[model samples]
Target: MTTTILAIFALVYLGMILGGLPFLQLDRTGVALLGAIALISLDAVSLQDAVAAVHLPTVILLFSFMVVSAQMRLGGFYSWATRGMANLPVSPPWLLGLLILMSGALSAVFSNDIVCLAVAPILAEACIRRQLNPVPFLLGLACAANIGSAATLIGNPQNILIGQTLQLSFAGYLQQAMLPVLLGLAACWAIICWQSRGNWQSSAPLPATPQLRSSDEQALDRWQSLKGLAVAAALLGLFLFSPLPHEQLALTGAGLLLMSRKLHSARMLGLVDWEVLVLFAGLFVVNHALQGTGLPATAVAWLAAQGVQLSEPWTLFGATFVLSNIISNVPAVMLLLPVASHELAGSMLALVSTMAGNLLIVGSIANILVVDAAARHGIQIDWRRHARVGIPVTLATLLICAAIFALRL
Candidate 1:
């Protein structure tokens, strides 16, 4: 049973690293689900044990935050933000700064993927209207969202998992992480601006078009938006002052959002990205079963004997960067989660893995989303084009984060 479980575990994670099983039409989520099903069938884990392995708090917290973000999206909050930011009569550099700041700030509070999903189209249209190159701004949106999500426990899935698993304080993690996040955001802007310098002047006038008005584009319930914002603000405040459980607070906030009249409860709930929740649950059980196999400790010990200690922050950072590019960030986090328990390990793992996404277009789902969205608008952002900026930005930001960690250590 132990050998069978270990074999399944190895194959599952190998699938994760490869982004699917060989020659199979499966994604990471499918691989995870299949692995869990296999474990259950083999009796490596009982149904009850499997149920216990899934972390309900993390799932609830993730679902709740997605609802809050959905409320904001439906309310035209992201559209309002993009238009407002674009209207500023500032130079490209200043505009870039504002984009980074807003993206980071909003992502810290909400899910970064949803932030990108909501903001990217509007940002693209705004850039076209302004006769500015949309590539830099789009890249900035993806990169900033990635960096900003690292600022808070609720900002991204990896951080949420890290926070829930380690029981890290919401406010405390913020205090520890804010400096590096700010520095990383700045690095993102600097790299982008430098790359876009001469090209900004060549931008043609934005073509005029008749389309939906701002009012028409406002798809969300106004009352629901206000309520969601209030709940989110209150949750943040609670994180700062109250000793209440964050998952509980966030779940309450989500419940409040669900009680909206203008938005159908079913539609709002439907937008919660249930597949991602399932992926997390499936991976949790698989990883838990793998942990029981004792391979993690044995692997760690073997590495240590060879002078390749993963517990060291730098070693972990490099490993995370490479693994993230290969497997994508979320699955990379799942693979590394078992061994990442150091005081600053979560922060290191989160920062490096997130930043590493910038190295290649495939390194993060956010980048892929941006590229695909651009293609719908007849724009192409191939890997080479992305890597020109992405590679440097990723390396520079990773170095800055590593420096921050080293200084604190």
Candidate 2:
């Protein structure tokens, strides 16, 4: 049974690393789900135990926020915000600064992926209209979203997982992360500005920008937007002052939004990223089963003996940086959560893992969304272009995070 569980676990993570097994229809979410089903089918874990292995708080928190982000998306808040940013009467560098600030701040509150999805195409069109190069601005969007999501525990999925699993304080984590995230965002603006020094004006003749469908573009619904903002603001207050479980409060907020007469529950629920929720569920079970097998503990012991310890913030940062890029942030956090013992471990994991997503094009969903979005308007941001900004920005932000963590220590 141990050997069988181990093989299943290995295969599942292999899928994570390669982004799915060759010639298989399964993606990461599918691979994770299948692994859990296999564990149950083979009696490696009982139905009850498999269910227990799942973390309800993390799952619920993620689902609830997805609904909130859906509400914002349907309200057309993102398009309104991004369009407003692009049309700002400012120079190109100032415009880059504003984009980073807006995207980062919005991402810190809502879903980073949703922010990218709604803003990317519209941003491309605006840039093309101005005859300004969109590549730097797009890169700014991806990098800022990743950095900003690290600002608060509720900002991103992995952060939510770490916060719930470690029982970290939302306000405390925010206090510690605020300075680093701010510095990271500044670094993002600087790098993009420096890199695009002479290229702010695209030399390529503006291609006719493709028109987005009416269904694709959402006009701002004032009432719905105000409603979503009220819920989000209220939740933030509750998260800070109330000692209640974050999932419970967020769930309540989601409920209130769903009861609105203007938006159908079906529409609100439809925007939820169910696949990611399933991915979290599947990983929870798989990781719990693996922990039961004692291999992870043994490996931690072995690494400790070799002068490498994950309990140390720096070591944990290094491990997270590599694993996040190799697989993905959520799964990587699941794997490393076992060795995370320091009080600052949760903060370290959340900040490092999130920032590392800016390193590669495949690192974050936000990056992929932005790149795909640019392609629609004849703006090709290939691996080389992404790497040029991604590598430097990632390194700079990680350095800022390390410095901050050191001061905290």
Top model number, TM-score? 2
- Residue-level lDDT of model 1, residues 240-335, one tens digit each, is 899888889989988878887677888778668887898898888888897888888898999999999887877888889888887778878877
**Residue pairs in clash, model 1:** 74-220, 75-220
Q: Candidate 2, which segments miss by more than 4 Å at Cα?
A: none
TM-score of 2: 0.98
Please give the range of 10 consecutive residues that has the lowest summed lDDT in model 2: 208-217
Tens-place lDDT per residue, model 2, 96-202, is 99999999999999978888888898999999888898889999999999999999988889999999999998899989899999999999999999999999998
The TM-score values for the models, in the order shown, are: 0.93, 0.98
Give the Cα lDDT of each candidate: 0.83, 0.92
RMSD of 1: 2.4
Among all candidates shown, the one with the greatest lDDT = 2
Ten contiguous residues with the weakest lDDT in model 1: 207-216
